[model samples]
Target: MFTRILIANRGEIAARVIGTARRLGIATVAVYSDADAGARHRDLADEAVHIGPAPVSESYLKGDRIIAAALATGAEAIHPGYGFLSENPEFVEAVEAAGLVFIGPSAASIRAMGLKDAAKALMSSVGVPVVPGYHGERQEAGFLAAEAARIGYPVLIKARAGGGGKGMRLVEAPADFAAALESAQREGRSSFGDPAVLVEKYVSTPRHIEVQVFGDRHGQLVHLWERDCSLQRRHQKVIEEAPAPGLPPEVRRAMTEAALRAARAVDYVNAGTVEFIADGSGPLRPDGFWFMEMNTRLQVEHPVTEAITGLDLVEWQLRVAAGERLPLAQAEIPLAGHAFEARLYAEDPARNFLPAPGPLLHVAFPDGARIDTGVGTGDRITAHYDPMIAKLTTHAATRAEALSRLRRALGQTHIAGTATNLGFLRALCEDPDFAAGRMDTGLIGRRQEALTRVPPPDDAAVLFAALAALDLDPARPFLGFRLWGSASRRVELVSGGTLVARDLRLLGPRHVAVEEGDRSTAFEAVAATPDGFRARHGGRNLHARVVRAGGAVSVLLDGRITDFSVIDPLAVEAAGGAAENRITAPMTGLVCAVPVTAGATVARGDILVVLEAMKMEHSLRAASDGTVEAVHCAVGDPVGDGTLLVEFTPAARRPDEAADG
Candidate 1:
């Protein structure tokens, strides 16, 4: 095996690769940008090198800089751990030219599958099942529209050059085709620098299943079963699992064989995934599924595969790079227990799932479960990178057990100082359809309301927070005692823009009553664990915990732990003179484009501007119909969240004397 390898990436994937490399006794080098200087991945590596600025184009995508770092560190190979420069064929060529092994497929293999249109054509020529779509070279908009017309309504326009759902759109009718195509092309150009797109049939009930393929230098290849990644939001996968639930034996065999064939067709080596869109009716057959795209590197959900097969794919990559061929025959790799992985992101699911970036005051992941994370307590979730917090994975003897374990693990994950999608993930795991293995791409979208509903903080939770905030000790004789026979303590909390106050009355050392206006619930303390507290309230048992020093309180509810702060209420006074009518940037990012300017009047629903942050364009819209008083920022400007972009006054209400209608 190679002595050292440079990981040409950052974040959790880099940390994950480092862990495997360490176990195999291979030294790892980490390359970081200015924004990632203090990243966990960089600190975990045997050696670290600074590449360039925080912008990916200046650092992660700089193939020459990465190769130089690898050479300087005496790395035998470079592992492109997904995203950034992972699938770039030119980067592969550069690594090869520098006489350093690129721990992935060859340039030729990447090129064969880089462009969707061309890859589809190639797959068809090789007799691999491909979706019926326009795979032609013609880029004329009219030509593409005509092709979509022939394919019928509800077609998919996908960017040919990139993946990760960046440049994809679904047009439901011919009337929307032109606009969708224009937007898709613009986003495509911005994301991949390629405006080319292909039209394909949009599967109504689709399940994303992909076969993991591994090949070696000796021309041997094998399939490592499959993963069902149907749980997605805006085309980005949110959750994934191995050994697809409800898959028919025949279909499973066909998908495995087809994935292997696809890899062989490209002379593919190392790890790659051939993804397919399958019908959700029943089991996935080779014929029922069509090739969607192929990821040319190690996948983010590889842990689930590892949990099921008990195999280390990264070690295999190292072995193959060191001139080894097929560590084990296809027949020897056995599929064992089921596994599930939930991608926990730092984003607010209620507010349209906007990315939330800030310092992680306290981070506690579920113990006894596999958690792949790059950030720890005290680390900052930078606005310059992906807002992924961690990937929580679990394994069990059965699918039901795996799902149950995952749900419980998600509840135990405690994160603070930044909003997260943990609540949504918890709700999703409890979703009946999801538990029954009947899931698809639209599952989250379909159950949007229930998924985003923030469960009300219960009596026990409130009592715990009150006790912590009041600095009341349970051992004290007068912790909740007062002068009167009935003593009441009131505390305020800020939930988003809403202000809520809770009244608490102590019955005894172990009992307390919490009231929010007309409603009241009683809570009884159980005991404290290593992490936090467990309590029972109104016949509903809950868990709550506290660490009093940092002005933050961690609470465990329904087996899931989340952190909330003791709102000082006095903090809002600090914003005394700031204009309240202004809409500001929510995070640090370049102003990709300003669609509006000073004196431009807009309605509440109008999109006022677009800010590109972390490679995603976030549209800032007017909160109410108003006339612009000032525009503080301009196009191409870098802005931080709360940096005022525009100030406006509500539109004047015309005088109506109950006359003219």
Candidate 2:
């Protein structure tokens, strides 16, 4: 085994690799950018090196700097953990050229599957079922449109060079084809530096299932079963599980065999995933699935596979890189139990899942579930990198038990200073279709409203915040609530952009009556755990925990977290008015484009500015027809959250009004 190794990545994956290397008694070196200077991964490694600036192109993607770091740190091999430079063939070649082992497949294998169009063609040649579409080299818009017509409506146009839902669009009809293609090409060029795209049939009921395959240098190959990653939004996997739920044995066998075939065709080495898009419309059949693409590296969802198989995949990678034989024969691998992985991202589900990048003032994950994270309390989720805060994985004897554990763990996760999708994940766990294993790619999109809807803070939550803000001891009664009997204490809270004032009356120790407006709910503590108080309200018991940080009180009640800003008595409130004419950035990002100039008239819904953040583009548009007064930021400018980008003349007239005048 190599004495030392380097992880050429950041975030949870970097931390994950360092842990395995440490367990194996190998010194680990970590590379960091300016943004990740104080990252957990940097501190976890035995040695750390600064690569470059915050941008990935200048830091993580710089293969030469990384190789130099690995060589300087005496790393025998480099492990590209999943993203960034993981699947880049050129990086792998550079590492090998530097006389260091690349702990993954050869450059040929990655190059074989790098492009979607070519990979589809290769899979077809290798006898793997591939989706019926155009994988041709022609880039003509008319040619692609004709092919889409030939394939039928509802075709998917995706960039050939990159994944992650970028440079991809779904066209339902011919009328939308041209615009979608243009957008996809533009994004493809900007993101992947390749404008090539392929058109494919859009499956109506798609379930994303992929088989984990491992190969050693000696040509020994094996399969690590499958993971169902159907729970997705914009092509990004949200929740994943091993031993794909409700999969027929025959279908599973066929998919695994095909996956092995694809790997063999590429002479693949180390760990790789062969993803398939299967029909969730009915019982899985051998012919009901088609090849999507092969990820030429370890997957983010590998923990579920590891949980069921009872093996360390990273160790396998290390052994394989050291030219070892396969650890076990295909039949000897275990699949004992079910496992589920939930990706907890620092994002707001209400605001279209916008990435919420800010400091993690407080961070507390549940004790039981395995958490893979890089950020901690006082750390920041910056706009310069992916906003995935952590990945929570749970394993149990059954799928139901595993899912239940996942939901429980999500509820226990406490974070402050940024919005998260914890509540949405809890709601998704309760989704009937998902709970019963009848999920599909469209499940989230279908139930998006119900899933993302933030429930108004209940009386219990508001009362908890009030108590925490007041620093009242719930275990003991106080005469405070004004000074006399029949007096109520009024405390103000801001929740969901609205102000709420609750009146609390102390009935007795461990008992309180909370009233908001015309309604009243009495809460009495039945029990108190270290985390929170279990109280009985309206004949039922519930739990509530409150934590205060940086002038904000956050209350976690009944599996939901709500942040309430305490109203300062000495502070004056600002009067509210409709500021719809002002167009500001929703989050920190780069001003990619200002389509409108100063004094330019724009109609409602017209694009004014294109801000790119967290690897996604958002078009800020006109709220209503108005003339632009100024464009504050130009293209290539970095902007912070709520930074005003453009302003329209206040109460600007519509086109019809101007014509009449």
Candidate 3:
């Protein structure tokens, strides 16, 4: 084993690598950008180095800077944790040239699997089955359209060098092919600096299954098993599980064998994942699976595999990099119990899963579940990187039990200062199709309405928020009571964008009555704990926790987080004025294009500007027919959220039209 190693990444994966290195008595060095100077991963390392600024190009993606940091810190090996330069073959070669071990596969292996088009070709050359698609060298738009036509309708245009659903488009008809291809190419060029692409047949109901495989210098290889990652939204996996539930044994065996063969074919080393798309419209079969691509580094969902198999994948990466043989033979690897990992992100599920970066005021996870996180309370989710908060995983003797634990664990998780997908995840866990293992990549899309529904705040939650806002302590004497009778006060609160007035009356030191509209309820606080309160409402005991920040209060009760905004009745209101026609950015990002210019007349729904952030592009459209008055931003300019990008003037009306009106 090496004396020291440098982690060439940030966030949870870097922290995860540091944990294993610390347990092995090895010193770990962390490299951070300006935005991540105070991040949890930097604090967890024994030594740290400042790479550059926040943008990936100037910081994490700079291979030379990362190599220099590794050498300067005397790190014998560099572990590129799954993102940025993790799968960059050039970075691996550079680390090796600096006389430091790259704790992953060789440059040749990564290059072999770098481009999807070439990788699929190589896999097909071997015995591995591949999806029928056009992987040729033609890049002309006309030629690609011909290929898509040949492949039939509902084809997928994917960037050869893209992953994580970036630079991918699904076109269901021939008329949409050209525009989708152009969009995919543009994103591919912006993200990967490569505009090459490939066309493939779109699978209607496919299940995403990937196998974890590890190899060493001695040519020893072993498969750790499979994970079902079919639950997805916007082409990204939301929940993943190991020992895929209801998967046939024959299919599992075939997938494992194929994964091992792919690794050997590339002479792969260290940890890697071979992803396949299996037909889920019917029963699983050995011949119904096809190779999608291979991830040349550790996966974000590796924890689910670890939970099922009693092995640490990071330790194995280190051991393999240190010239040790595989830790366990293929037959000797242990597999037990079902495991599920839910990716808890600081994002709003209702707003098309928009990334919402803000401070984490209160963060807590439930017991009996393993939480791997890189942020804690008081940490801010910056816009410079991915907004994933943590990975919560649960394990049990059976799939049903494991899923139940996951549902409860998610409910126990408390968060504040930003919108989260906790509610959406809980709903997905309770989905009948999901519970029965009847899932596909389109499950979330088909059930989006029910999954992303935000329940209205109940009376109990509203009352709790009111109490917290007023700083009312039920245990205190008098509690601002009237001399003759119980003191009463009316408070205004807002929940889910609706303002509501609630009446609160203090009955005694430990009792209170709440009235909203035609309903009224009496409650008594039996005990007040640091974490929450134990109270009796309507003859039933209830447990609730309150998280207060500024004028916002989130009441967590009965596995639901209901947020209420305290309204200030005396605050001055802005005068009703003519509608301002300025279009501002919805989030911090770089302007990718300005489709409209000043003096240009555009129809409603016309694209005005395109903003790219967090690896996705969002097109700002004209809300109404208007003439562009000004274009304030240009392509390549980084703008903060709410920065004005364009201004428009309503289209002028003709004299005859005005007379008719």
Candidate 4:
């Protein structure tokens, strides 16, 4: 085993690697960018080094800097944890050439699977059931169009070197193919430095299932069963599970064998995953799955596989990299119960799942589940990296039981300071099709409106917060001795777009009554707690963590966070509201494109600006038909949140009120 190793990554994966390395008594070194100077992974490791600035091109992707750090820290090997330089074949070769081990597959193996078109061809040649599509080398737009026509409409255009839903587009008709291809090529070039893409027939109802395989230098290999990653949003996985629910036994056997064959074809070693796109129109069949691509490193969803197998995959990687034999043969590998993993990300589901990066003012994960995370309270989810806060994993005797535990665990999650997709994840857990295991890649897209709708916070909890905010005394207002005089006050609070005024009267010590419209509710035990207050209403006890910053009050109750902006009668506001057709940056990020000029006219839904943040490209479209009055940003400009990117006025398409926020 390696006496010391360096993790060439950041976030949870870096932290995760340190955990296993420490357990094995291996000294660990962590590399961080300027943005991650205070990252948990840096502190968790035995030693830390600063590589470069926050931009990936300057930091995490600088293999030479990472190698220097590793050598300086006396690391025997480097572990690329799934992202950054994880799958870079050149980086792997460089590490090996530097007289240090690369704790993953060889450079040749990664190169073989680097490009989707070539990977598919290789798998098809090896009889691994490649998906039917255009895997040719021609990159001409017209040639690709003809191939898409030959395959059929509803073709999926994927970047040859893309992963994580980047540079992927699904075209439903021939007319939309050109635009999607251009967009895909642009994103692919910017993200992966490769503009080549492949056209594949889109599986209308598809399930993403992958098999985990491990190998050693001693020519021994084994499979760790499979994981179902069908729950996805925007082509990215949101939830994952092991021992796919409702999967047929025969199908599982065939898939596992195929995965081993694919791995063995390239003499693959260490940990890797063979992804498949399966037909989900009916029961899983042996012929329903086709090879998509192979990830040449540990996967983000590997925890689900670990929970089921009860094995430390990272430890296995270390052993294999140190010239040891495989831990267990295919049959010897233990596969017990079902497991589920839900990814909690700092994003706004209601805003089309845009990345919401800010300080994690309050973060609390419930017990009873294994949480793999690199962030906690006081940490910031910057736009420079992925916005994943943590991966919550649950394991049980059965799939149903495991999913139930997952739902319960999510219910107790508390986070504030920025928007999150917790509400969306909770809704997905309760979704009928998801709970019943009738899942597919298109599940989220089909029910996006319902899933993204955030549930309202507990009323009693919000009322108690309002009452507390109304108190003039800042210190222990909830514990005031108001028994001698029952004072009444009216306070106004606004949530989302709704405003309400309520009358609050002290009924007794630590008790109050609130009146709004014709409804009167009584709150008992209204005492202040360390973080917030607890109250009883309608025979139910409610707990809320109330935080007041300036006039904004945020209340978290039962994992639902609501920000209430207190209305002030003494404050004067400017009139005329925000300008029409004005679009601003949603978060701090680099501008990838300025599609429109100052005098250009654009229709609603037309691409105006493309912003790159959290390593993903987001296209900001016009909200109405308007003429651009100004283009304030250009490509490659780093802009902050709410920075005006474009200004425009309605072009008389309809009433201006239709454009009001």
Worst 10 residues of 3 by lDDT: 477-486
Poorly placed runs, candidate 3 (over 4 Å): 481-486, 507-509, 575-582, 597-606, 622-630, 648-659
- 402-504, model 2: which lDDT tens digit per residue? 9999999999989888899999999999998899999999999989999999878888887777777777666556457647556578888788788887788
Judged by lDDT against the true structure, how good is candidate 3?
0.89
In candidate 1, stretches whose alpha carbon ends up further than 4 angstroms from where it belongs are 281-285, 480-486, 525-530, 539-541, 547-550, 560-563, 567-581, 596-604, 622-633, 647-661
User: Which RMSD values do the candidates have, in order?
Assistant: 2.9, 2.3, 2.4, 2.9
RMSD of 3: 2.4
**Residue by residue across 1-661, what tens digits does model 3's lDDT show?**
9999999999999999999999999999999999998999999999999999998989999999989998898999999999799889988888898888999999999999999999998898889999989999999999999999999978989999998888999999989998889889999998899989999998899999999999999979999999999998877899999989788888999999999989888999999999999989999999999999999999999999999997999999999999999989988998899999999998888767878888898898889899999999989998888999999999998999999999999998999888899999999999999999999999999989889987777777777777788786667743565645648778788776677787777777677777877778888874566866667887788888988889888888988888778788788756664345889887888998898899898998899999888888878888788789899999999999889999887665434556888
TM-score of each: 0.93, 0.95, 0.95, 0.95
Query: What is the model-wide C-alpha lDDT for candidate 1?
Result: 0.84
**lDDT of candidate model 2 versus the reference:** 0.89
lDDT of 1 by residue, 1-661 (tens): 8899999999999999999999999999999999899999999999999999988889988999999999999998999999988899999999999999999999999999999988888778887799888988898989999999999878999989968888788899998898678768877887899999999999888999999999999978888899999999888899999999999899998888878778888899999999999988765565799999989999999999999999999889889988998788989997999999999999988788889988887788867689999999989998878899999999999999998899888887878778899989988998999999998888988998889887666566666666666666655633555746657777775444444578877677767678877887776764555555666766767656555446766565565444556687557555455454777887788776677778787887777777877667678887678777788888789988888887777664312422443
**Tens-place lDDT digits, model 4, residues 80-105:** 99888999999998999899999999
Worst 10 residues of 2 by lDDT: 649-658
* Candidate 4 clashing pairs, residues 3+ apart or interchain: none
- Candidate 2 is scored at a TM of 0.95
